[model samples]
Target: MSHNGVQTESQRTALVVVAHHRTDSLTAHIGRRTVAQLEAAGYRIDFLDLHAEGFDPRMNIEDQPDWGNREKPYSDEAQAHMQRVLAADIVVAVFPVYWMSVPAVLKGWIDRVWNYGFAYGRSKPRLAGKRMLWLGLGGIAGDDAALPAMQEALDGQLNAGIAYYCGFSHSMVGLLPDAEERPQRLDAAGNLNIGDAISGIERDDHYVEFDRKAAGFVEEFLAADRVPA
Candidate 1:
């Protein structure tokens, strides 16, 4: 692969999954940016726009796990998705943080595709040594008092509970708050507070900073792969 006119031997593939219904959403925009960055970094990108591809998150009988059979055959759709996962050296999931967690579609995608036999339920995990980055777009204000606790909760749920449990060598949750056009926060009494939306240069600057911060998260994630683990 070549990056910036420099030829290289690394040919890593990154499965960049975007779980947003609308193609014009901020989440989707960030997802596209992520793909571009990965490409520039010499990763062959297998971009999976779940909503556009009409991925049915609903679990069916064919995809259901049979605890007794660890090598059960899942639905064709599920198997196809699993193949993509298997082909990738790294996985980056970008989505809006709904209810302080991933959206229903993403959760269901995992429930169905990342099934017991495929992602887990074995002494030798298939996803072992793979890296994962979850870039969740959040609506909460950047300086909200609840931000720290929210980040901690998300880290525990996504990194510790799911990724590490599934045997991923490294997994990170890059929570990008201030995603909403109108700022939002929670008070000490747990009341929702919505602030005015910025316009003109303010809005432009806001998104500029947002993009920079988002890029920083992705860069940091990539840099970690170079370190000894």
Candidate 2:
């Protein structure tokens, strides 16, 4: 169906799932900026603000018993969310690192959304051939010592747990970290000077051009065809 004037058939659809509890934080900024770039690139964007949408992180009481059950019943909303995940060619998860891992909301989103018979447990994954990006933000520096545990956790949790479990190739999993440390010059309203961050990372620009370039590489990787294994 064509929603928001976006053709679901012809145009490539990208779902940007932002899981930041705080709207005014750096996590939100990165989510918004990435969406802007993807939208500008002509991809149909579905900006899913999990917090704003009031998505209950905890599964419903009735559904709790079906945690690992293969025959679990999904509510209409849950079904729709899964459909969206299955429909998209690319899924972008944006959030902040909390305690060296994703915030509870994002983790819960995965727990509830990626269910049995959908994300895994069959001969193949339901979301196979799809791609994903794990875009993260945190106050910690990007040095090896500062983020060793975080990196390992992300690789295990996101890379192994979600992406690989769902049969998405390793090339499809991209990570962008330390968003808060990026040099940025923006007003109180988050109005960033486009040229500054887009110029160069070492430059006095407002945004982090290097980060953007890295994100672009991920986007391009997602759009590439999967080779036979």
Candidate with maximal lDDT:
1
Deviation (Å) of 213 in candidate 2? 5.7
lDDT (CA) for every model shown? 0.90, 0.69
Writing each residue's lDDT as its tens digit, candidate 2 over 30-80 gives 787777777766678888999998888787764444546766767766777
Residue 138 of model 1, lDDT score: 95
Name the lDDT value of residue 16 in candidate 2: 86
After superposition on all C-alphas, the RMSD of every candidate to the true structure, in Å, is 2.6, 7.4
**Best-performing candidate as measured by TM-score:** 1
Instruction: State the weakest 10-residue window (summed lDDT) of model 1.
Output: 1-10
Over 4 Å off, model 2: 1-8, 65-71, 170-220, 223-229
Query: Candidate 1: lDDT of 140?
Result: 93
Clashing pairs in 1: none
